[model samples]
Target chain A: MQIVLAILVGGAFGFVLDRIGATNPNVITGMLTLRRLRLMKTILLAIGTGSILMFGGQMLGLVEVGHMSVKAAYIGVFIGGLLLGAGWAASGFCPGTGVCAAATGRRDALFFIAGGLLGAAAYMATYPAWKASGLLADIAGGKVTLGTVPGSAYAGIWAVSGDLLGIVLGLVFVLVAFVLPEGIGGGHVQEMPAE
Target chain B: MTLDWKLGGILLGAVFFAAVLLVKPIGVSTQFVILDGIVADAVSPDFITQTDEGWTSTNAYMAKSSGKYAASAAGPLNYGFVFVLAMAVGAFLSSMLRGGVPLAERRAPEIWRANFGDTPWRRYAVAFAGGFVVLYGARLAGGCTSGHMMSGMMQTALSGYIFAAGAFLAAVPTAMLIYKEG
Candidate 1:
């Protein structure tokens, strides 16, 4: 039933990642430094395409709004983002990519996965303590489900209309990928540390 | 036609099909369970705790994990963990089929050598530390790379946009530095 369809869908996603070298950390790392455009291009494409499908589906009533979880927490997000970003710069693979890379038998990816698990586990284990201590006890939303963080007016566009917003962002993502081939290529980006 | 898109459609399409054919959907929060199981076994006291009502715990387990499972993020049996595992399995199976396995790079550059130890153990340790910091941050941020960026943006999540900026800003530099050393 639904589960069956899910498996098929998942397999395809993984297949694409593998074929595109999404499972390769070298690609991710390269893309970040602006050396490789391959992996970034794939990511941009996924985002652009995914957004369009979601918007169109919702607009057509093909799916429920509830399916798209919109809840957001900025404080947790900000700190966590900083940490994850630094990690990516260091390790090259995000959580999902790292796991996939590990499966591909990449030694570094395995290490990344192992580290990811530990980090995630630690966060959860300490959540209760952090909550009780009031360290993160009062951290609340600076924005709503749609979220709001200054410096990005493009979001105001999204807020005006989900459908319009979806189309615009989706198109923009693709446009960026297309215009800056080097910025978002596949597994062979041009990045590397400046010696 | 974008080569990445065509390949993305076909490859991810395959992942999509395989997911439907195998077990459940793909996700990372779901992997919390496997992580829980492993960390629990690896570290004593296991985070999961059994109660009169059942188990009450954190993101993954002590077998006491709660909050959300696969079917939904709010309930039990969180299948999100399963998706992460499936991602791993699928990738593993594919590489195996291709006859290509993990290979260590012994020719790391001098810059990299300075930043990281020349040994595998040291390199893995640094990576582990990096993973730990990132995942810990991801949860605090209310999501991981997937949650805040891909899934978040798909939902038109403002948080996702902000998260993406932060991610790229930091990640891009790191990649460049490493690539240089390598």
Candidate 2:
């Protein structure tokens, strides 16, 4: 029963995202360049709604507080994020949307999946070499998430959250998507007329 | 840009969740089935273990508990792997039903053509490099932002915030350069 509800909810989410034109690079780029805040607004709204539900779920004792996994490797995280960003721009699809594109049977997406899988395998294959080589020896096992936040060790782990960062990025993207227009978004989505 | 956001947002959230529950959970990480395939092809073919792990029983039963004494079951392929497969199937099915125009072959955008054509492997390289980076970070910090930021923050984990910030700082320059031309 619970699983069924989950499916019903997920399908609806996928459909709306596709329709929002979130699947389009133009919209994503628009958010980054500030030529259009459409994507930004959509993302913010998603985040906001998610936040409320999470908090509420916790207060109601419906969700587990400790079961959430927190395994992170700085280099991998940084590179993964950086790579994902570039891949999105270069390929016009991020991990999430890429899957969406693939489902639509976009030939390009099929290749992206192929490339992505190759990448994953490559990592696993190298795991032995990398681990033996001391790539991960420097870092200790997982620590509390907030411990990485600067000057916040005394403030508590929750303070480690980069909400400020998310907001800043969101705002920057929203602004760029709105103000820059041509240089950022299209330089001219319409191409001017007359004199 | 002009669509009704309230309705749109609700609908999308549902799509994401439904796909996960119905077919597989959604995770880009799982598309590595290609990796599984290649590994199966080149490696010893026994690289992935067949040993009895915890969820194998559930999978066996789900696989129809086929036969009287099968001794084991495949269950739902690794959690991540299943999600990845479902995502592709879901995306493809939805795109067609929605009447999205097929991406043109000849008229493929310069970005699309240049990126994939001049150097096909570069895509693989970038992906490899990116996965190396993301997974590394995920392991180091204790969790990817999805587990931390999205799931954690929602649950109010302090660490979630930390990971989220790091993810953004990392994503900035990459997004800028990649999308610079546009």
Query: In order, what lDDT does every prediction score?
Result: 0.57, 0.42
lDDT of 2 by residue, B27-146 (tens): 344334333443443455332233343221112211122311112112334434344444444545555566653445212323433334544355445534444444433433434433
- Tens-place lDDT digits, model 2, residues A50-118: 444332333355533333333433344444444444444445555555556556544555565566555
Candidate achieving the largest DockQ: 1
| Model 1 CA deviation exceeding 4 Å by range | A1-6, A129-159, A183-195, B1-6, B9-26, B37-54, B58-66, B69-78, B97-119
Candidate 1's displacement at residue A77, Å, is: 0.4
Candidate 1 residue lDDT tens string, B1-182 = 12454457334433422332244223464365345554554465434444565554434323322423212422333345445656676666665665554243323322235446476676676667878777777766666766677766655666777777877777777666555643
* Candidate 1 lDDT score at position A167: 64
Per-candidate TM-scores read 0.76, 0.63
- How much DockQ does model 2 earn? 0.21
Q: Which stretches of candidate 2 lie over 4 Å from their true place?
A: A1-10, A63-75, A129-195, B1-26, B31-43, B52-80, B105-149, B156-182
